[model samples]
Target: CDYELIKLRSVSLEALGENEPGASISRCNTLRCYPAKVPELIQNCCDYLEKNALQTVGLFRVGVSKKRLKELKDQVNLNRSLTFDVSTNAHDIAGLIKEFLRELPEPLLTRDLCSPFLNIPSS
Candidate 1:
């Protein structure tokens, strides 16, 4: 069982690397610009959210169906133009954005920066 779990984890990580969201930012081939730093997946999600989800009450707090979220992830991972509709649930895209950030190989906040960030007092 342990061996099987490890094998599955390895396969999942390998697939994650091959996909867009979890890929190393520098090497990611999707919608990269010469000087712009944001990944296309993130940019697209933010754009959609800005346009549609700004007034949403529980924007990030709400949970979405796993099957729907998976479908959205698969679409984003394709690196193709956004195919999901504008009418699509905002929480679904928000969930996808959260998943993308979570899956990054390195934490968005690096270890060295974590201490400094944590030390800062709340405003």
Candidate 2:
């Protein structure tokens, strides 16, 4: 085995919500427009499903920068709620839900539960 010193370089992950112009919006936007907290973001998603039922076919995707995710994670860890100017950062509620899911460190469902969850009856 050859012992050679090699240098490692750090590269940033791709920015969220940038590839597509209208596909996703900023987390700040959604927080301001819907006036939601980290926890409330999930509730809003539930409400949307309840209100729209199966009729909700179209929905915009949500995206947030890694920096924003870190900020949100910090706030959530510290039990702080997000706050921003509504007029300036108004965003889609659906998008915020998507962002929340995306930023989670682990999948919503555990590996063991995944099988049963997927097996749930559609009816």
> For each predicted model, how many residue pairs clash, with residues at least 3 apart or on different chains?
0, 0
The TM-scores of all predictions, comma-separated, are 0.68, 0.35
- CA RMSD for every model? 7.4, 15.7
Question: How much lDDT does each candidate structure score?
Answer: 0.60, 0.40
**Tens-digit lDDT track for model 1 on 1-123?**
121112222222333345445544434443442234555556777888898889999988899888887777556545443565755888988887776666554566879799999999999
Which regions of candidate 1 deviate over 4 angstroms? 1-27, 31-34, 121-123
Cα lDDT for residue 109, candidate 1? 86
Task: Judge candidate 1 at residue 52 and give its lDDT.
Answer: 80
- Once fitted onto the true fold, the runs of candidate 2 whose alpha carbons sit more than 4 angstroms away are 1-59, 62-79, 88-96
TM-score of 1: 0.68
Model 2 per-residue lDDT at 37? 33
